[model samples]
Target: MKITVRQEKAIDFEDITLLNDIAFGQEHEGLLVERLRKKTPFVKALSRVAVFENSIVGHILFYPVKIVNELTEYESLALAPMSVIPELQNMEIGSQLVKDGLETAKNLGFKSVIVLGHKDFYPRFGFSPAVNWKIKAPFEVPDEVFMAIELLPGGLMAVSGTVLYPIEFNM
Candidate 1:
């Protein structure tokens, strides 16, 4: 089974939404993707999909967010709601999407990315606890689960503050 990863297209919208819903066993993530797509912070290049047999089997989205303190606001990307079809969960489809998405993000000029995800899975991609860099999540979550990765050298080194997600994330 071969899988191809590529930037999402308008034509893949419905498949992506359905993929997210089925993978997550809920509709909230699918709805969030739709809402975020309409917002200014949505980076088209960073939203990727994994295609297997010409069908979208996985999806990942990285949206603009801020780490702000009184002195400054550092722009970054947030990896949220990454999904893979249940039947394909352990086949590395999600990994490919993440790797491709992160590369696309860096190439597009994004410096860093944060994710609230499985402690074990993300570490393989070089993510570490955001707390190590004094970064905080908008809500309470376990330290290991809230991770961050630098796309370039020292990407998060000078940044320290709470992440501010978009309004659509809460809706």
Candidate 2:
């Protein structure tokens, strides 16, 4: 079997919507992806599509985030609403998407990447609870489920206080 992963294109909107709908139903995740695309210019092209059999079987999104602190501040990234087609779940597509997104964020000088997700799931990619770094999500969630990955050395040091995602996130 041959599979390909490519950056989604303007013409791919319909396909993206289809993928999201199948993966997450017609609700929150679908709406969030729509809002993110509508609001953020930095969707990180390299982060969006994972194709298989010429279809978008997996999708992930990363957007700008901020960890405001008294001593230091830096631009960060947030991972949200990742999805894979129902038939493709548990097949590691989500993992590849996340790994690819994080690598891109790291190369782009992003200091950190945050994810609000399942506790058992995200840590394999080096995500640790955000609270350990004194950072937090805007909404209430389990501390272990709000994870952050420091892309650079000591990247999260002195990074306390609320983690502010862009307004589009609708947290």
RMSD in order of candidates: 0.8, 2.0
TM-score to true structure, per model: 0.98, 0.89
136, model 2: CA deviation in Å? 1.4
Residue 138 of model 1 has an lDDT of: 85
* Model 1 weakest lDDT span, ten residues long: 41-50
Q: Which stretches of candidate 2 lie above 4 Å from their native place?
A: 69-73
* Number of backbone collisions per candidate: 0, 0
lDDT of 1 at 33: 96
Residue-wise C-alpha lDDT for candidate 2, range 1-171, written one tens digit per residue? 344566678777777777777787776666667677777556647457888877788888888877776676667788876888898888888888888888877777778888888899999989899899888777788898889988888988877877777776664
Best-performing candidate as measured by TM-score: 1
What does the lDDT come to for candidate 2?
Answer: 0.78
TM-score of 1: 0.98
Q: Report clash pairs, candidate 1.
A: none
- Worst lDDT run of 10 residues, candidate 2, spans 38-47
